[model samples]
Target: MSKNYVLSLYNKMGKLPFGKKLFSLFASNKAPYFKTVSPLITKVVPSECHCLIKKRRKVENHIGTVHVIAIANGLEMAMGFMAEASIPTHLRWIPKGMDLQYTAKAGSDIRCVALLENNQWQVGDLPVEVTAYDENDVVVVKGIIHLWVSEKPKK
Candidate 1:
């Protein structure tokens, strides 16, 4: 089977100097809304993706903390990258829903991780676990982003 295009791109570009940043820029351009949080995609491998959102003024709320929605955007972006990297070539996936819990105040940069087990890529309601941690490694948000996976239509 051919490698997934997103994975292939990552494999190629992720090795260059500042490649991850460039790749993240490319991804954000593809899905413009994700640019809102200025997400920096640090890593992408089979079954997992890591992203970072700095606690800048744009992502901060009136309470002097990172906004929950900004964190959600980062989580969603990580989940998308994870799905693109991990799903079988013959299958397709789309986000069906997201359930998040704001556990702690995000006072610093947030690192978001999305994870899926290798065996969890079958056609079904797949739940990708996502968590956001602050600079101190405290859980700021955690959630599941549900994906509806199905076989690709025969062309």
Candidate 2:
């Protein structure tokens, strides 16, 4: 069986509308909250998901910097994409929670690099490390995303 959906879609088509569509569908069907990430998850994985938030008035904080929640969303999306690319077909997973620290002022654009090591997700709570980098590649936000992984259900 094929291992990862993003990897399969990315193999047929590079990063673009279709890849984003499939990623959105995966989120839409499973967890609607992840749909918030559709526009930001521009790249495919197991390559790091380069999530971005434009410097729009809507996303800015009172100080005119990127809002903390926006960073959180992108960081979460990055971690999710990495998980989809790394997890085996025999396993099922869902994010359990996250612990984040905002270390710097985020820029107009943010990049998140989150990856799971081989065999990292067994059959329980797995804490995956995620960090969002500012334009300077300095970490603006860092966190551990906990995902509960289990054996896939029998059809």
Candidate 3:
């Protein structure tokens, strides 16, 4: 798709209530990050995005703390949002790997925020490192996103 077309679509989609759902429709099964975040994401700003997921009673483990995997999931989703926003429509991206550390017990809501530099990025291979924090502002997880770009890759 043309850059102009994609940017225009994003602008239009941004106005809709279900703007985030648009990602699901396009990627569907491969869009797990979108599914995980769409419901909890409260806001998306220029160069940054904020997500919120409540610590439900059901989501807690035996110790009454939120599951470690749940927190990791939120971090990945937030990072994905940042990475996606950084790339152009002609490119594609995926989570290469992540290194996370669970500090304190998560008894309340978890928020993941991703920020990007406002400067323009030239279209090419890109990898973004995103860090997620708990309600107490302690780092809970970190991810290194590796994104591959190609007009066409060998199939």
Candidate 4:
């Protein structure tokens, strides 16, 4: 999909609590690969964010291991949600870059636990690293998310 199209969807999503649910349904219906590795934001608080993904055959690569792209997409999903949740209602956030390291093979379900050092998700221009782990608790990917912050109208 085009970046403009995706950003338009995201902007619309920022308006509703159940937006991700509806978006996921639409995405998974049209692109069933999403059904396998789509990450869902389960909970968010001031200090932490939780995301979950299911392992399924559809996301497996040629060797029956999880595709690297799929894992990255899941990581981005979690990071995006946490990035959105961490900032106040008066700010807009966009990812600038990502530094990733794949430490282990992903052969099972995955969960991304994004811990914020403070409630601050934005402080001008800076990058944050969010780590993801597999079901066995092994580090699978570390994403150093670079984000640009701007002010948005208060909700």
Candidate 5:
């Protein structure tokens, strides 16, 4: 079978120098709201996605820390990519809800990871676990992004 579209793109683009940046840019363009965090997608594969968001003024709150909303944006972006890479060809998914907690101060650049188990790829309210860590590897944020999965409509 042909590779999933998103994974195929990543496999090809992920080989070139600065390809990850380009791919992340392309993705952000497709979903404009995700641009708020300026996420750099580092890895994309079945069941998991990794992303990095630098702690810049644009993403920082008045307290000079990465904003909660910015971290949420990164988490959502990672989850979206992971879902795209993991879902079965006959199925599709959309975000239904998100529940997140700010566990610690994000004092540095953040790494966001979104993960789903193989069996969790079925239809229903699939909750993809997501976590954001600071430079020191402290869990700065953690949550679930709920997705509604269903068979794709007939063409």
Candidate 6:
């Protein structure tokens, strides 16, 4: 089974200056559409991934808070990191759907945290929950993401 590129990179460059930004740069190209949402990954580990999305013109809502859609994108980026590193190499997975609640206006740069307990992983479909918080530590968004999981085809 092949190693995950994203995890490989974090292992090699996770401590360097601007390393987190560099990782996100790579992700921007790998998933170009996500670039529009502009996620910046700050940290990652087997159990969790952290990300930030600044409130800027590209992602700001009419009232100047980060948009809910942009917050969703941040959640997705965090989840993608976990999925890339957590799924067994011989298994394949895809997002089936996601349910999110926008609980408050994201008044500052939003911090997103995606998590999956080591014990929750299994061989079939899985649901991973993620949350995004404002600078004040208030949860601005919450999500439950469903993913379809199965064995990889013989090589």
Worst 10 residues of 5 by lDDT: 117-126
The clash numbers for all candidates, in the given order, read 0, 0, 0, 0, 0, 0
Q: Could you estimate the TM-score for every candidate?
A: 0.96, 0.80, 0.63, 0.70, 0.96, 0.92
Candidate 3 C-alpha lDDT tens digits along 1-155: 44444334445676888764563344334465445433355445444555666777755789987676777666666656555555555556655566565667777677766665562334465555556566787765655545544443545
Model 2, C-alpha of 18: deviation from truth (Å): 9.0
Compose the digit string of candidate 1's lDDT tens values, residues 28-103: 9989999999999988888999999999999999999999999999999999998888888889999999999999
- Sorted by lDDT (best first), the order is 5, 1, 6, 2, 4, 3
Q: Which clashing pairs does model 6 show?
A: none
Q: Candidate 4: where are CA atoms >4 Å away?
A: 1-36, 153-155
State each model's C-alpha RMSD to the native: 1.0, 3.0, 4.4, 7.3, 1.0, 1.6
State the lDDT at 139 in candidate 3.
66
Off by over 4 Å in 5: none
Q: Judged by lDDT against the true structure, how good is candidate 1?
A: 0.92
Q: Once model 3 is optimally superposed onto the true structure by TM-score, how far is the C-alpha of residue 28 displaced, in angstroms?
A: 8.5
User: Scored by Cα lDDT, where does model 5 land?
Assistant: 0.93
Q: Any idea what lDDT model 3 has? A: 0.57
As for TM-score, the candidate ahead, 2 or 6, is 6
Of candidates 3 and 1, the better by lDDT? 1
Worst 10 residues of 4 by lDDT: 1-10
Candidate 2's displacement at residue 134, Å, is 0.9
lDDT of each: 0.92, 0.72, 0.57, 0.66, 0.93, 0.84
Candidate 2's displacement at residue 15, Å, is 6.6
